[model samples]
Target chain A: MKHLLSASDLTRDDAVSLLDTAAELASVTDRAVKKLPTLRGRTVANLFFEDSTRTRLSFEAAAKRLSADVITFTAKGSSVSKGETLKDTALTLEAMGAQVIVLRHHASGAAQRLAQSGWIEASVINAGDGTHEHPTQALLDAYTLRQHLREGAGDLEGLSVVIVGDILHSRVARSNVALLTTLGARVTLVAPPTLVPVGVQTWPCEVSFDLDEALVGADAVMMLRVQTERMTAAYFPSVHEYSRRYGLDSARAARMPDHAVVLHPGPMNRGMEITAEVADGPRALIVDQVANGVSVRMAVLYHVLSSQEGAP
Target chain B: MSGLANEPAVDRAGEREIVLRDIRLMGDRQAVDIRFADGRIAAIGATAVAEADPQAQILDVAGRIGLPGLVDLHTHLREPGREDAETIETGCQAAALGGYTAVHAMANTQPVADTAGVVEQVWRRGREVGLCDVIPVGAVTIGLSGERLAELAAMAESAARVRVFSDDGICVSDPLLMRRALEYVKAFDGVIAQHAQEPRLTVEAQMNEGALSGELGLTGWPAVAEEAIIARDVLLAEHVRSRLHVCHLSTRGSVEVVRWAKARGIDVTAEVTPHHLMLTEELARSYDPLYKVNPPLRTVDDVHAVREGLADGTIDIVATDHAPHAHEDKDCEWGAGAFGMLGLQTAIGVVAATMVEPGHLTWADVAQRMSVVPARIGRVEGQGRPLAVGEPANMVIIDPDAPWLVSADQMASRSQNTPFVEHTLPASVWATFLRGRPTVLSGALV
Candidate 1:
């Protein structure tokens, strides 16, 4: 609960509690003026050493909405450029009274280092680390589905979702497999051979390459955009060929059940992953995922930093 | 000479005052005086040269020897990105303290040395520091991505004028691709220095794959994983008739392969690092990440084989695969830690104490393995030299008998990642002279 380093450590109740807190936080954004004084006088720092505009901006906005002072620290234009070490940076941030740190770094286990180094007393939250997990994104996706599917609009008991893309380089797939399965939802990962990391057989989900089989009778289909830079020299035949097979075109999107919905974690390629019609269609929750990002991050920040010690 | 008024009295000394006392004279146990002036050997005699000038400096070397300046074929400066780990300036300072006059700066840095721009950046920095002559090793694969060949000809023509090419942190795994690279480098007489790990075999490998890896419960980095590639590359080198330099040769099995290639004259050279020569896999039982390295340390029996291999001329060079890492990068659980340890300042003594005093090697052989042979393998010019008149004064005055304990904080490299920090070793370097000027005096750099 202190640092969301990995999703596999979360229990069923822990996932539900975090999801429920995010729902309450999401409801505040619907008011005439979205603002809260819950985290007043506290300081939250978005210390992103890696590039993720979506995640960085979400935490920044979430901290500000709660009336907490937000400081966004990135690698560019910082003393990190001047050969200062990470522990030194964290100590400097701690000296400035940062209570929570949301960090993303390129090296694997970098987030764990910030938490364990004792350089900063701030509560840590992992935004995304190398080939590891992204906890908040999975929580938001779970919250986005529970609004319609959960019995009391709470826990997803019998829902089904499929995450399709580069599962090897994705922290998103790792986090979702843990959180979605914990909440009693069937999860399937669709990826090419090169796109899957080793030892997925032990993961708590059904991994398949046949997107057609996974698409049938799905309640919510989350299409993960392929990270192109990691492909470096062509992981597949071509982007064009990848889109022709696994992309959520009109024909594939129409194959889902009537109650099914679509989700993507934005910065989408227009004609590649999701076509223009499916992205703007009613079943798509693309925009809502962005909206939900702030709420889930706020809830995560509050849960870790706040003194609320009531439930699991 | 703005500071000419405050110059030292040694420069004022007349000709015959330059005396080389306590001379083993190429590892033969005897005393001799080799006179020199303006940085060259003037004479070799049984008696000391008289002080022809009153202001002449006296170098009283009682029980030591003389050899050529040391050369290292592999050293990671970690500049242009990870300066917290090390920089070329600091690494070169350490190299001088270790009695080296030249070292090859590897290409694995931020924005990698795949391009001519980064290679020049590193090469120019080494010159600006003026510690040692830095031979920039260009990347074989672009960005070290292992997909396509880099602009080798362009980098070879830059100010670095690179001749050694490698994807050193990783292997050029595909044999066909290795052949093409070997064939391509033939046009320019460039050597492909391979790191020699099979990618598929060492996916999660942590240490040397054997009883040690089994006991530690860490993934095994098999010895054959390195040997297999050496086997394939040696034959490939024979076919292409090009030079192939194997980086950080560990294990007795690899020693035999290099020995066979050398006997057959297949144009191959191999280097054993100081750590591999002095330490063994048994040190891994301590569970320190500082002791962790790629091409992991083998057994004591293997250590003897390496020493024997170096002596009998199977191994060509004694490179200090000096790598630096930050505290956070190394001070962690074994499996979660970084690979490599600091080597530059510790190498000479480790080589001397472990080999020189053991009668397995003399200072002459040490000079051959550490400096002369490395200079030939790396094709460095004007670095490793005999004490002759016309050679550039890239040399060192080593005590060769002063015992000293190494401390991590005493090192010039920015990172405290040395594995042999507390160990007391013999044969310390007292001073080093590069280009007729003192760079290191009394074992400290000026």
Candidate 2:
């Protein structure tokens, strides 16, 4: 609970408590004055070593709604470009009294290193690291799933979730697989053989190369964005081929159970991994995931910064 | 070869002649007295007590184990280029402290030791330091670019007398170039030491490719990248009938390949690094750059296999691969950091802890793997000699029962990048002698 660096760090109870807190905080968004005084005197620093506007803005909004002062430091305009190290930047942030650091770095384990390096005392929340984990994204996805599938149930005991597309490079896919499995959900990852990592067999979830087969009994299908940059390395022969093999088009979306929801951590590849029609369709909870992102982040900041002890 | 009056009795004017009393030699239960004088073993016998040499420094070593001086066939001095990281002087000091009488300085320096000039420079600097014999390994390709063969014959004929050629940090990935280099070295009785990494497969490899790498999200360095090259090189060595040395073998598959090649009577020798035998890829979970080395630490299963290979003589030797990098090079993020660790000072202790303590190798086997075999592979002379009368008097006394905590500050290497920091290891090198000169005594560099 000290730092939400990886989704795997959360236990079942820890995950449920964050979801419940997020459920309670979701009510504030409906009010005209959607602000809370929970973190009025605290400060959160968004130290992003990578360019991630969406995640940074989401965390900023969440902190603002909780009344915590926020400071934004981007690698492009900061001393990081001048060769100032992560440790020096962290120490500077500590001097500025940053109670929590929300970091998005290009390196896979930057957030973990920042937390464990003893360079600073601030709690670290991994906004997104290089193909590692985005705990908040997974929490928001879980919150969206719980609101739709479980309704009043606190645990997602028997729900089946299928995650499709570039699982090898998707931090969202990695985080979701970990968090969903920990919540008693059966998760299946569907990707092309090349897109799957070397050790996917060892993950808690089952893996499939066929999207249609994975979609059969799934209550939720999450589509991960196809990174075109990775295409240069020829992970797949062509984009058209990838779309044909793993794309969640309308037909494939319809093949799912009637009550199954479709989720995508945006910005979606409209014509690639997911189609425009399926992304905006009635079964799609993509917009709901973004909204839940704010609430989930608010809950995380509350848990890490507040004086409250133990599970909520 | 005793004495002109102008030449000091020891190598240096202030150096002391020492006689060790009642020290137990490795592989022998009986203790004997050893006398060192005039840069050679003056006498060694059951009755040659310290009382015979009244002026010699006398020490009683009851439980210490005596072994031949270790020789490292693989080490990166980082000199002639990255002196801020390590130099010939500092590296030799580190080697001497690690109980090494000699180390093959790798050829991946700034200008690369491709010519006689560079090789002789490294050789002369080692002599100036006078700690351990630093044999400069000539590059197989000029500037380690893997384009053309270096001046191997000139280097072999120079004052350095280099016999081992390697482009260690960069693989001679071209097959024709590798074959030509192997064939070319045959005239001089030279060996080509290969790094054995396929660059195309390990484009941005950060750690071993397995379940742990997938979970950690770091790029996977597949074992096949190393195995494929080894398999090809062993075959090439067999076809050419030349000697080949594999550097820092880190995979179970690589061990099997070497074992199979040896079974086929191929003229090939392989060395396992101390880090590979003692550490694993699980350490990368911390993402500390200290654990990030080239031919990255592998799984526990690979460690077991390599140890078994060494124990059964399938693997010929243990090399330190003592690579040092500056703080800036290793203090950054894992991807940005350099690919090596400080191994010279901790090599013996690690070997003792991983090999001897596990009953995989005895103290005699330690000497052979760390000393005798490596000396033969690198063609190093006057080193790895047995401890007896008229030997070169190059040896070390290890207190096998003593345990000491490793601290980076205590090491002689210029860079403090040892991964063994804070680890308590059994066995300490009590003293080390190079050509009858005591370079280290009472666990401190003389």
Candidate 3:
């Protein structure tokens, strides 16, 4: 969980190893047992201050499928609904004796606080926090991409993955940029200037506002959901304006390399960020990202809870 | 006669002796008698033509300008959902001090003002708070999901009587969706206020897509993302024969598109934010999250174009997209923070420094854009009225030459998210009136 705070927390070796484990877990999902005993007799709690159905459920299912008891705490109705401080909730959850806590929060550095707060002895997993990162989501996305792209357990040494859309407000984009770069994959972020965050010059990736050029020769394309709510605050103006220039309708989707696939974190603004034709298209790995979410999380829970002696 | 709930409380004992010696009214600067009565302008005329009662509350403003109270078509109070950041009362107080008589409350709230019930709740809260008239903008979509249209007729029929339906922070981006929205609102004599951004092109966008975005290593939100949407929506409005108000029109391309749309006789109106008209991408050089806005600040050319658009009436209003943010939402590194800035209190001053002072817009033009046009777009019956008898008497007195420095400490909004901190700007507001009652006196909220 402490490692879930920032992408800088993980060394290249640790990230690569996690990817490898995800591959192994991916293979295991095809087996008849489907269930893993990795975290047996333990309890994992999902503490999500943010409302993300797919991510929250994936971690929930991952913990349950691993034979570990799962406790779900969403910010919507739980003590968080009382506006009870996250600190108090953390203390309460800690008292309940949770072994691992997968947390998603709206504020950046929230998970980092829970990990470093010394409130509990549980392992931590970052589902996502603000526009900071979602290591597990990035891992699962990469895992899904690698299955179709990298063959025979080969490394993604020289491949390319282009993340397109609202990178400024996206925790998922941040995670994908760092993790993909760490694995030696060429990362390209394509977005409007208003969509990109400040101080991105030092990151290891090529930045392009032009989607047509960014998708050329790309091995994978990750489409982000353009939050309309963020725009009325004058982030950007009008959805028709956003869609006409940036919408990943079928025409733009066809511009990618034939082998390239489309990815989104879900809750898609269909016909706006992406056309229904493409989100439902054959090359779309959105559902795959959701599926791999479980496997990657299962691996994360197992590694963080069991491999305490050689912890990264 | 309404109560003093929306008026600035005049402190009886602390009165001072001063006079507005030379009142600059548009082109001609002349000596005039400006008296305050019941927290309103009881008389205004050439010095020889009018007399001030000795007992009347007198303030010396020898070399200052008095413009009508400013109005904002766009401002997010963040109440009922994120009041930890700002409230209607505090937000309106900030607006009053900034010389605003009315502000349109955006619909992107917790339960979202997509229905009459929610708009009434928000409207009642704003009225009960007694700061300024908060005109609730109905949500364009049901949950702002953009798939279904909201109850335009219902919202229009509500107590707030909302005439503007917008998914402001969220775009009604779908074409068939936008066309239908434009058509739906037209039946009720409403305008569909568009945020004008392409979602797919700008997904995860941070700042303007350019050398700066490359230098900052942040994701680029291309100018085209905004321009493309404006171009299409303007044409869409023309096709549907419905009126469209483009909110916060930034970028030169967007301005040109709006101009072309106007030339083609499309019933398209546009607005520019004080931040966009004044500041530029150079602030991004500081890496401060506060300066990092959505539609990221464009280049100087874009700034000049936005100013010109306003000057030539291509942009019809000057709205302050006042957004308040919690500290944690903006305190982190740019990549890890939310996108927004507080603009209410600093909006007029910023405009005075950037446009009014520079001659791009005279104070008369300022009154039109900031007062009259905004009221027209929002359909506030009594607000932005002519300066004559029998009106609601909403107005402001500006010490246009008053130099002031901006700091977060003076802000009334719950969150101190302004990017203009440390900015030294010309002009300060002396007082503001809502229905003949001063809500701000001597630059302080009553």
Which is better, 2 or 3, measured by TM-score?
A: 2
Cα error of candidate 2 at position B145, Å: 1.6
Chain A superposition TM-score, candidate 2: 0.97
Q: How far is B354's C-alpha from truth in model 2 (Å)? A: 2.1
TM-score of each: 0.59, 0.96, 0.60
Model 3 / residue B241 / CA error / Å: 1.2
Best by TM-score: 2
**lDDT for each residue of candidate 3 in A119-225, tens digit (9 for 90 to 100):** 56666788886666788888887788777888625456888998888887788888888787877799999888877766677678989988888888998888888
| Candidate 1 structure quality by residue, lDDT tens digits, B1-446 | 31211122345334333555665655667766655555444455643365323544556666466677788889998997899999888899998998888889888888799998988888888878877778889999998888899999888878777889988889999888899899998887789999989888887777786654543334568788899999899999999888899988898899999999989999999888888998888777555667889888888887988888988888888888898998887865455678887888888889887788888887878888888878777667676777665555556666776889889888989998888888998878876765545578778888
Error of 3 at A240 (Å): 35
Deviation in Å, model 1, residue B215 alpha carbon: 3.0
Tell me the lDDT of model 3 at A173.
85
DockQ of each: 0.03, 0.69, 0.05
Q: Is candidate 1 or candidate 3 better by lDDT?
A: 1
Error of 3 at A237 (Å): 32
Summarize candidate 3's per-residue lDDT along B1-446 as a digit string, tens digits.
33433333445343421223355543247646554444444555653124545544455556566666677899998877988998888898888888888788999989888999999888888777766888899999998999988888999988788998889887778989999999888777899999988998887777787766654445678889899899999989999899999998889999899999999999998899988988888776545577877768989999999988998999999888898999867754455567778888988788788888888888888888888888888777667766643345576777777788899999988899888888987978887766556678888987
TM-score (C-alpha) between model 1 and the true structure? 0.59
